[model samples]
Target: MLADMRDEVFDQDRACQALSHDRDRLVEAMDSGVADIDRLTFPDGPLTLLDLAVHVTMWDEINLGVVTLALRGRPHWSLDPRWETAEAGGALNVGGVRAGRGLTEELIRHRFHAVRQAHIDTIAEIPRSQWEQELPFAHSGSQPRTLGGLCHYVNTPEADPTRKLTYQHAAVHLGATSLSRAAPTGTG
Candidate 1:
């Protein structure tokens, strides 16, 4: 049973399934909210739906790149010089949001959907056997340094205890709290 569980853990199909499930939840959550994504704003939250879409798409793009590189026997260490450091992640998010401003609402939505599809498609390309292959870079602590681990880490937020199985980052952004909040004063 241990071997079966281990096999399932690193299986490409399982990884894609988890990713697709979270993406569906996020899309459903977004669809049920304010119809005008350009005007969808959260009270006390820094991002509008447009901004949030850009931010999420940016991370998806990054994940796609990382997985693509790993598949080619390359290390993703230089994708961000300080990618391994949690403190630097906020800056990356901030920069993505800033850079994505001025994009049309339609374009932002399109990119978000397209990039997510590409990310899942890329993950599906990883072979079952190589899913557990250790990545070239050194991982923090005993966290699995395999290809599956990289995908799991990028998808799951630091605060989530469930780790490998959930997309807590998407939940943090598109969850009930974010959906229910009223727009902050003076912003749309």
Candidate 2:
């Protein structure tokens, strides 16, 4: 039991630090005014720098709900029969981008900071046992089974390889390749 508590604290610290670092980097990018926030970064999709901020914000908002529900020991509301028809987050992603479209850059940035802080706060307060409890939302192969796993997933580089656009390119003015070799840090 004591060992489990230590592991939970370590995981929680790492997650909160990562989220804080990610939020600062993204915010610095948006405030820099160097990148064309609206310019599409990829040919395969309509993702702009602003859209990326919105995308992350959307996921943070969703996770907040998931974490809150799990903390309360409530069955995940999304585990309904209608999940059969859901497009496994493709729809959610598309709708997130669409919802962010045409919004002022300031609004997206505001939400990016607010939602991230909320997520970090929530993660910090979650009980040790709650962190390990398997979330009902883990249906997809990529989905993490526990709240701790979800916290790690959203903050790590593998979750969004294109994170370079928001981190290195915009924040540090470095090449994308530089971030590819960088490891996830425990420091904020």
Candidate 3:
């Protein structure tokens, strides 16, 4: 059983590494503006470049905080929208209007790079033994998940498929069929 657990930890480490790499690539690509971040779409609707940037930043912070808590054997933060929104406001503290006032591609890029680096560092510092330990996280409210499970949730093939479908739906809803049409097959 210990060997199995160790193996799982190794797998989780690999997965975390991959996620870090992928996130780095995403930050690089967005910073480069090669793909036009302004046109990015989410599952809910179209996002302005600033909106996408904010979402990415928020996602990184939330995920990292969860992983950090898991490593420390503490309850993860609540995922209640109201609570999270309040928490996010306190942590991020920048409003859209304020963000828009002085936003530049370079600035957004720098922020994302910093955020990504912090996540990478957190993942690297945590020990493998903690991967199997349950920590509180919240999709809707505080719940428990292993570090390995969180890693898997973020990168699982199933998640990719689901996100792709969600993006397609968003495109359709927004009358942005061109975006959906341009998406590569098997993107997820």
Candidate 4:
């Protein structure tokens, strides 16, 4: 299964494109209400919608950071800890889910949009050759995931991918059906 996932990661460009498209649909879906966001039970306990948003945002930012590093061959400047603290502090609005509080709907939308755009830019800038490079024993638990691995996870189905995918897949699966109406006929 890991090997298959590796093959999928090699198709990073496709994964990036898919992720960007899915993110757009997710943002649109979220426009309905905070309740639209999925919930998960964290080890700490049950997570609220706001908590789920923060969790998703964190994963997206981390993936974006990894992709940026892979493309640029260096790390970008990190945001100030204060900003993180502030964001965390506001996580109480949705019953301490660490999301849906302190932030207006528009602000949440813009933040997600910016993250998605950054991912697109990173994907566009990275060369295919770079993505194929092997970094054996370089990625473990603490280190960032390799570009190839990240890409694969995005495009391929997993027995149980990260929770992030559960939220994203819901949006994409729905959008694919809706958007099919706009596709050229005789293709499906």
Candidate 5:
């Protein structure tokens, strides 16, 4: 019991620190990326840099809800209607993320911070035992995932899920590859 208590604090601290750093990097990327938003586009889809930011916040929020529900052992995606729409459409669907609201740079940035705080706050409140409880997303594979797993999934990198939630995944990793891929090849 004592060991679990220590592990819980450690895990929550690790998650909080990682998320804070990720949020910083995300904001930095936004500062630079937004300037060229009009020129950037994903070849496989219709996502602009702004669209990507919305997508990041959009799914991150849903993941927050998932973690919240899982902690209670009632892991269902009874979250914002917008998230349901996003899930229905697919990962890259800008329309689903937008949900009809016009996304200004300011709003997206604000939303980014707000959602990150929501995720951080919610995860912080969970007891240690809950972190290990398996909670599948609306459409997950056989392998079970927990709150810690989700945090690791977003913070850590792997080949699949190509687009991660934020920080190392979205702002750093995806932006790293996509910046070059999205750039037009021609003499300026």
Candidate 6:
């Protein structure tokens, strides 16, 4: 059992490391400060480079909360949109906005490290028993989802629409911002 648990947890650790490493490489690619990225835009509405940075932290916070609850063997939790909107406001209050408004490239990089570490700690602390258990996504899907599965998916270069979209999002922010020689070393 212990051996099996190690394998399960190790995948998650590797996935996390890859994500962090990618972000770290992004920092390297960003030769200029936040001012350089101020014009960062999404083809979609209302999303900027700052919004992407803040959303990453916000989702990290949300994922930690939901996964923690699930690991504790609690019922699936619901995230209030009102609560999320308010939280976004707070992110802005801190240094989540763009160059002159709130955030700097340095600070954004720092928050990514901090929030990603929090996720690493949270995942490490979850018991092995909860790993394969099903976890609810923020929205419903016909497909099933599980804690361990999510870890695996993010780490591995699996082909799926959702995964593709996620990588697309990451590319828009991290890829667009900079380029580095860092090849992803983990499942992702």
Off by more than 4 A, model 6: 1-10, 31-51, 75-109, 135-143, 150-162, 165-169, 175-183, 186-188
Candidate 3 residues 46-111, lDDT tens each? 455445555556556666776676666664553345645544544443454245336786777677
Report the number of clashing residue pairs per model: 0, 0, 1, 5, 0, 3
Candidate 6 clashing pairs, residues 3+ apart or interchain: 155-187, 155-188, 156-187
> Which ranking of candidates, highest TM-score first?
1, 2, 5, 4, 3, 6
TM-score of 6: 0.52
Alpha-carbon TM-score of each model against the true structure = 0.71, 0.63, 0.54, 0.55, 0.59, 0.52
Q: Which tens-of-lDDT digit does each residue in 1-188 have in candidate 5?
A: 01212112126655665566555655666677642333233335555555656766766776676666666655544333453453453643445455524766788878888987887777777777777666645323222366676555444323223332222335443444232211122211
List pairs with backbone clashes in candidate 1.
Answer: none
| lDDT of prediction 5 | 0.52
Q: Estimate every model's Cα lDDT from 0 to 1.
A: 0.61, 0.56, 0.47, 0.45, 0.52, 0.47
Worst 10 residues of 3 by lDDT: 1-10
Query: Superposing all C-alpha atoms, what RMSD in Å does each candidate have to the true structure?
Result: 9.0, 7.4, 9.3, 8.2, 10.3, 8.8
Q: Write the per-residue lDDT of candidate 6 for residues 41-99, one digit (tens) a residue.
A: 33334554445555556556556676666565553343344533545435432443333
User: What is the number of residue pairs that collide in model 4?
Assistant: 5
- The 10 consecutive residues of candidate 4 with the worst lDDT sum are 179-188
Candidates 3 and 6, the one with greater TM-score: 3
Residue pairs with colliding backbones in model 2 are none
Instruction: Show where candidate 3 strays beyond 4 Å.
Output: 1-10, 36-51, 80-102, 136-144, 154-188
Superpose all Cα atoms of candidate 3 onto the true structure and report the RMSD in Å to 1 decimal: 9.3
| TM-score, candidate number 4 | 0.55
On lDDT, the leading prediction is: 1
RMSD of 5: 10.3
Q: Between which residue pairs do clashes occur in model 3?
A: 76-136
Give residue 17's lDDT in candidate 4 (0 to 100).
52
